[model samples]
Target: MTIIKNPVIPGMAPDPSIICVDERYYIATSTFHWTPGIQLFESKDLANWQLVGYALNNEEVNLRGTNTPAGIWAPHLSYDPQTKRFWLAYSHMVNMAGREFNADSYAIWATDIRGPWSEPIYFTSIGFDPALFHDEDGRHYLTILEWETREGYQAPGHIVLAEIDLPSGKLLSPWHRVTQGFTTRGCAEAPQIYKHQGAYFLLLASGGTGYAHGVEVGRAETIFGPYEAHPSGEPILTSSPRHLFSLGDPDAGHFEMVNPHSVMQKAGHGSLVHTHTDEWFMAHLMARPLEGQLLNPLGREASIQRMHWTEDNWLEMEDGSNLAKMTFKGLAGVPIDNEPNTDLFDSFQEPQYLLEFMTPYRQQHQSWVSTQKRQGFLRIYGGNSLFSQMNPAIMATRATSFTYEVETLLEFQPNHYSQTAGLGLYYDSNNWLYAHVTYSEEKRCPYLTLLQAKLGQRIEYVNTRVIVPEGNIQLKIGYDHGIANVYYRLEEQETWQILLQDLSVAYLSDEGVNGMPGEIGGFTGLFTFIGAVDAHQHQSYADFAYYKVTNHSPAS
Candidate 1:
């Protein structure tokens, strides 16, 4: 028995799609509005995960200026042993603002996991959250969530299974809508099909994507027809411990949750996979707020839970409760240890961008970024302040927690007054902390200023002329939960000085002190950055000396 804690892969690691191939496990997750998208993580142990690479690095997958909850949606990974092929299914949830739920789904297949993955073969244009199942006899069938948009309907959602000739990527038969006003919660979607003991089981994420979120199950003698909901008739897994009015309704995917207890809201929509030794694990979403009091900036992070099966085939939490925690063991009982983990710190010894780096839209201009020059320095050319969700020069990584220190070395000599670069914490465009040195040409003097932007307001608390005889310096940011402080030093200064004080992260949080609406929810974490901004630049670049995360304080 091993005890892994809650949130196996912390901070906005949402829409987890896990697959086991030849003893190697791979997990793919959604990266909404953050470019260099679709991070892939690998693990030998089910409880520990490490980033392997990203699925989309082209500028086509926009992250800059992209809104919350709108980039990539649910991703599914499957392995077809016969062909030794890894097929990936995903959706680009474009234009979520008007609630234009119309999604563009696509499928990509790879022969080598390290991929030169085939260009996506567009799947159905009408839905999202798609999965594929390859049966024992070389038969391929597709399962996806078909939108139920008729207004007067009980729930505008249902799960459908269609047999498809994937080689041509077309449905072979009329899709079967296996769910309607029935057992389990109304928003029945994210369905996975599996066979055992001569029977097939259909697993679904019910209620909408919020408070009523739950994992539901059904079984049928056949893959397409006459399926019966699990006898329990309620969620097999849910977080309604105290049950509040907010946990009401229970939407289509979790549509039932009109209101819910704050304990664990938006807890469903997932895919389950069995370890080689037959242990069960599930990948689902959760959210954590910037302000302890409100779970805003609603980003969906992926959390894994353990499962045990009864002789009669009911799936349950290993200990019979869905309490969110970090540790769980594989059924085979391999040796386990709880080592403290870290996000990603780059010393740049490899002469390439670390896996932790991401751009706004993966803007294919390789000339824009590099790691080959200085062993630990990352060079990025500034281009745009922020563009549409489609593009921006900004680079960002996952926000691993509510509090953590992000420090980096920056060495840049600007050619013009417009080239100002440094490091700080960012929520979105409307709100962020900017701590950097701007060239003051009118005075031929450099100045260090702590500029804070709260939604509609921009406040500069510390604006002082700096004596930077040299061009290189170090920048550090300390976030005590949500309140923030900025620190920096000139070449002559021996120690870091606190440049700013008493800042509120809520301005950058879901509460929306800024122009943006706060995040909706799903336990996603925040992302930090160490880069340059060319808001108004004339061919100038910032060389990131190196960025590292340490237990040591940023101020020191």
Candidate 2:
């Protein structure tokens, strides 16, 4: 048998929705405030996966001014065998003031996974985490969480179901309120429906998306009714099985329920699939914290687990334990060469950018960033500063490993200090660590400086400034766990000089950054980026010769 390791897809891939069509498996994940909204991955053997494409590649949804952890929420992917098409449903969260949680949900369809997708169909504003289920009899239904806003009404409201028309974007029937939650873990969301042996099964993500997170199940004879909970009266899958009761809590960051015994945390929000080989597997979201710290810099990742049906028709882990495992067994006949390819080197020789690169808060268009502008070089015209929620000229990739290095060759001549350009590590608009090249009037030359933003507070490393003659400079960042080191070298120099050493950047994480009050901070993971800033005028730009990233170790 093949041994499948955990986290088949790593780095900020959360809320995974898995589906199999024609024996080929596909997984869609959440992107939050990042553009090219939903991430999609494809796998052939269910052991090795590759980044295929994204659902929102154009200006389908606007994320400008979207707050931290509030842009594009969970994206649900399902295939309709009747129509021979793929359907994607997602939420565009606009505001979270006073915990009102205003959002607009939409669904789009395409004939192929890499699509010329149809325009979005407005579904509901009542809640988030919307999923679509197509019955065998040619009827479609939408399942979503009805957000609760009153003083006290069972916390996060109910899981409601409604029949919908795919062609006209209309609801055919009134919403039927399903069960509030299957277990006492509360905060039930991400409702998905499955049919097995003439019984409809309802699966839920419970106990929020935090430490107490888990996957619970229920079943009923009909589509919507008084569903019966699993006989276990607990989550069928979770990282922390030593449970505590949290019935009415609305908080998504349950810091108290962290499982110290397991290396994985927040293992929940799962989606199931039956393989072509008659095997069962589930794709779920999980997180890995920094060593000896509660802060999670890598955000939630994707992991797979082997599952089986019990004699009594209830779902259970293949090992007969509810706890999530770091390693599991794969299909017997499937052979996988599990060597990870996490390194990237982009020379900008091609006409198009790499598919792994993603931008935040704004769509990537030729007006701001392009490779055709300067052949063999990436020319990025600066837009706004890193603090702005609007447009920022940043092309970043997820940090997949804890021990990695990112390097770039930048050629920029800034007339003002506001037009700086270089490489750095970014989390969001409010949290980052930048090592950039800026002009200084007193020195009359370009210099390298380190800047950091922690919890909205800016810290400048004035003592580490080193003046260098301008032309082309090579910048590099070495990151190990929570510490970072910056280095630079001139075009003619044969050796590298350290600019900043042993700088603690542990605060650039989900738990360290401050977001909506009484809620989890940021949901997106850390990113290594090559960016530019033109706060003075949108005229100055930077030309990058090449960008490279090397991973020394895996996240496990």
Candidate 3:
């Protein structure tokens, strides 16, 4: 039990899959297109996991035109002892641009966990969150959420089971709709199948990934069920202490919460692991909104809780209570200590930029920032408006652990008609907080001003012109609730000016603002966007001496 306060793994680190092989342990999480697709963490001890390497990189797993929140889905990781190879199954959500969410499922194999993985073996058109089970009878099965999109159907889909032929990547058994989730609420997803004592168990995640979200279970004598829901008739774990969050999508209400707590939010969707030391733990998603209000940005982070099973085959928390905690330390595989939580503070002292920076649709060219090009600074060639809900000249980091802070210093001159570059906070291309320097030839001058992406609309001229003086400058942003206040300095000797641009409504947090379903609106987290906009013919490149981001608050 690693009692990790709040998010153990942050940003879109949901639906965690943990596996123990020998004395080593591994954790794999879903990455929604911050290239270098699946993030894998290694640990000798459950409490301190180290980022060993990625499961898939852009070169290995291409997501060239993948849309925001649409590039990848919950990835399930498993090891086949017979094959002695690790298998990763994931959905490359290619159609998110059209908001279709119809993704292409893929399977990749590797002899070593840190791998030069085999070319992706195109798998069936099965729905997302595909899990593979290797049974004792030498049979392999694939279980998925068979998406039910017919009219009258609601959010939180259904579950399906099929026998998959590993060699050919085909579904040997006909897909069976196991649950419409009508009885379990709309959330019939992330299903994992296991066998113990001649009985098969199906572990599921439902309740829409919100406060009502939960980890559920059912059992069947056969792989394909005429299965029965747990006699308890409700989720095994949930966080909405208040009972306000519905367990299933609006319809399955018979087991609705008697009480709910608002403290933990968007908590559900899970996978389990029996550690090398024989301790059982479950990895699921959870969130903490800004100051316990709306604006949950640490989207579906990875959290672990301990669980126990009895000879009768019923599951419960080790302590007989279903409540999860902020942190818990369990038995160690090998004692592992960790370094203080830190992200890269990139100074171009190295030849290349750290892979942590990601662009909207395309990978920003290396020529765009290099050792030879602009001295020590990384220069973003100003290209497009930061307002488009699509690709913008933005590079951001995944918002991990709610309490961390981010700040950057930038220096640039805007010349082109629509060229604007600056430092600000961004959740996605469509929603962000920016203060840029743009030029207007009609006025025959350039100025540094504040801009923002609010309610899907780019609002400008809030304070039309605070003309930027011609010289090296610095821009800074401090964020708490996805909301931020802007500050700037003209020279090293000057004090920071509080640019009065309050980003209260920029992230689309309220009703009818910055998000699309579970994809956008729920909680995309906060990020620093250092972008260049090209509103005209000439390309504008903005030189940033060095961009520094710190979780340290200036007030501290």
Candidate 4:
């Protein structure tokens, strides 16, 4: 047997929904508040995964002014062998004010995974985390959380099921309220249905998406009926196995349930797959906190665990323990040789930016950002400031490791202070650190400065300004654990000068930032970006020669 390490897909890939078509396996993950949403990955050997493409490449959904952790949520991918088409269902979380959690769910289909997808068919605005289950008998069902806003109801809501027409996207039957949760850890959502041995299994993500997160199970003889909880009366998969009863808790951030013994936390929201070789494995979301801190700068990642069905038809971890492991056994005779593709170097030589690059709030288009404008450089026309959720001209990649360095050669000349372009460590519109070049009126020269936004408060490193000669400059950020060091060097200078050192960016994390009263601040992880801001007149633009990311840590 091969030893497969966890986190096959790292950094910001959460709420994984896995499906196996033929012998190939695909996993779809949520890309909240990020454009080109619903990231999909492909894997053949179950241990190695590759980014194929995104389901939402066009402006099928509007995310303008989207709040933190509120945009695309829990994208579920499914394949209908009968129709030979791929189906994707996701929710567009529009509002969280007053904890109403209003969202609209929709589904799209495509003959191919990467291609011209059909127009989205609106399903319902009742709740979020919508999933589609294509039954073996040609019937289809939609499972989603019926978000409860009543004062005296089950906290988040119940996992409801309804028959859905695939072509017309209409609900044929009224929703059936299934069990709230099979385990004591409540806050259940992300319901996925599977069939095995004449039974319909409902897999749920329970205890929220935090330290108390886990994957609970329930089975019913019919498609929608009274379901029986798992025999264990606990989550079959979780990072923390110790029991804690949180039935009525609506708060998703169960910080008190942190298990010190576990290296991986927030192991829930799983999607199971039965391979062609008759082996079973699950793709789920997990988080690795920074060393001893509860802060996860890398955010929720995708991890695979070995699983098996008992003689009684109940699913359990292959190791017989409910706790998720960092390393598990792979399929027999399958070799695990692929490593994580965390390191990236894009010189913008091609007509298009690398597919790994993603933007926030706005979709990537030739109007604002393109590589064809210049032969060897990516020219990005400045849009709005990072503070605005509407439009920000940023091209970023996920920070896959705690100890990594991002470097970019930027050629930008700013006439106004509002027209600045450089490298940054960004979490969202409200939390980020930028090292850019702008006009220095007093010195009468273009200089480099550091700006930070911590929980909506802007802080400028006024004393750490360095005057640089015009033209191309190399900007780099060396991130060690949770701290970041900014450096810059002129085109002619062989050595780099430090602009800011020992700046603790731990605040740019899910738990560090402030969000809605009872919810986690941010869901998307940290990203290193090459962006330009033109809040003045939107006439300024920046040219980036290359963007490079190097990971120092070993691939997980």
Q: Rank by lDDT, highest first.
A: 4, 2, 3, 1
- Candidate 1 residue lDDT tens string, 1-556: 6655556676667768888776667889877656656778887776667887767765444444455556677778888989889888888877654444777888888886667677778879767888888988898888887765566553445678988887678988988987643344565667888777778878787666655666777888888956787665666666543232222232322233423344345666667778887778877765554433544443556677888777887666778765443445554756545453754677666766667776544453556677765566777776554322443445566666555678877776665555667776666554566676667676575556656566536666544445454667788887766677777877777998877666667545434532233224222345576655565643667778678655332110
Over 1-556, each residue of candidate 2 has an lDDT whose tens digit, in order, gives: 8777778888889999999888789999999899898998998777777888999988998888888889999999999999998999999999988888888999999998888888999998999999999999999999998988999587877889989999676899999988754657888999999887788888899999988899999988899866789988889899989876777878788888899899999999999988888888889999989988888888899998999988878888898888999988877687776665768899999987778899989899999889998999999989898888899999999988888999999998887888888999999988998899888888777888888888778888889887767747999999999899999999788888999889888777788787655457987899999999999989988999999999888755
Give candidate 3's TM-score. Answer: 0.86
Task: Provide the TM-score for each candidate, comma-separated.
Answer: 0.88, 0.98, 0.86, 0.98
Clashes of each: 60, 0, 25, 0
Output the better candidate (1/4) by TM-score.
4
What overall lDDT goes with each candidate model? Answer: 0.65, 0.88, 0.65, 0.89
Residue 204 deviation, candidate 3, in Å?
A: 0.9
The alpha-carbon lDDT assigned to residue 95 of candidate 1 equals 61
TM-score of 1: 0.88
- Residue range 132-223, candidate 3, lDDT tens digits: 88888888888887654555764445688889888678878788876643235455678888776788878887766555667778777898
Error of 4 at 205 (Å): 0.3
Please, what are the lDDT tens digits per residue for candidate 4 over residues 334-445?
A: 6667655679999989986788999999989888898888899999999898898999999999988888999999888788888889999999998999998888877777
lDDT for model 1, on a 0 to 1 scale? 0.65
Candidate 2 CA-lDDT value: 0.88
Kindly indicate the candidate among 2 and 3 with the higher lDDT: 2
